[model samples]
Target: MSKHQLKAVYVISVAAELAGMHPQTLRIYERRGLVSPARTQGGNRRYSDDDIELLRRISELTDEGMNLEGIRRVMQLEDENVQLRRELEQAREIALHAIREAERAGARGGGGGDLVPLKQAVAVFGQRPSIFDRD
Candidate 1:
């Protein structure tokens, strides 16, 4: 798993302490759907580092006078923004790779893929006389 995908290990009390909030507050946030901590095999809540950061963000939004619903909406928008940014980066990377492959194919005199642009794809590839030229 990636660093961000690390399993939750911090229990509620520790997570609350790390986030500088009361344990009860953490429970409230869970009930509010603000945070979704992982559950242990025994059905216990375990918060990860990412969850701690989320708790901090919740605290910030609350401090800024945003209601729980408003904070939830803001977080949803932020999550969408992050997902779009990541997808855009992946698309850019794919485009760059395609460009590089195209360049290499051109350097090899177009001996690469089976497909080509219609504008360049004459039915007769070699020196063949057209029907117009025939009469």
Candidate 2:
């Protein structure tokens, strides 16, 4: 978590004020599963900066006439999109590292008979095996 996300410093009232909403409105949002603020040891709700930003986004979506369920779905898809992008970036980095290792091995005369290049092909297996077929 980023520093802003790690620090749940704002109380519900302060968060509501920052998000341009009433405190009760914040509670309603929580009840609707729109926002989940952090809880203190005493069970008080504490909002991080990220939470405030999310509240603002919810307010925007609501102002645009989206229902709560629609907003929740949109948010879920947005989070999934971000996670997929991160995973793709990590995969690209891993591929590049493997390519570099292969290049280094070839440079040092290590790419000999030990490593065989693979030929990728598709196999169709719809037909059943027959005793007449030779191995």
Candidate 3:
């Protein structure tokens, strides 16, 4: 989390103002499992910058004429897409490291058949583009 996100200092009213949303709308978002803010010992809601950003995203999705379920699914897929991209990048990095290590070992000892190039070693999950990314 960023510093701003870690600091859940905004009360519901302040967060609503920052996100350009109503306090009741924030409450509804929380109820629908879109945003989760922290609660104080006194049982007041405290929102982080992350929550405010999510509210803004929700607002954008709504403005685009998407239903709540469609917005939820789009957000879920976006999260999954981001995660998968991270995982794929990590895998590619690992594969590159292994290829370099094998090349070094081969240069030292004349054995090079054990390792494969990155394109051959790694498998992409899906190349299909998202509807949101379509023209």
Over 54-106, each residue of candidate 3 has an lDDT whose tens digit, in order, gives 89999999999998889899999999999999999999999999889888888
Worst 10 residues of 2 by lDDT: 113-122
How many residue pairs clash in model 3?
Answer: 0
- Per-residue C-alpha lDDT of model 2 across residues 1-135, encoded as one tens digit per residue: 446446999999999999999999999999999998888778999999899999999999999999999999999999999999999999999999988888888878884624575555454588654543554
Off by over 4 Å in 3: 1-6, 110-135
lDDT of each: 0.88, 0.88, 0.84
Q: Sort all candidates by lDDT, best to worst.
A: 2, 1, 3
lDDT of 1 by residue, 50-80 (tens): 9999999999999999999999999999999
- Candidate 1: worst-modelled 10 consecutive residues by lDDT: 114-123
Model 3 / residue 122 / CA error / Å: 23
Candidate 3: pairs in clash: none
Q: Which candidate is the best by TM-score?
A: 3
Off by over 4 Å in 2: 1-6, 112-135
Question: Candidate 3 at residue 79, lDDT?
Answer: 100
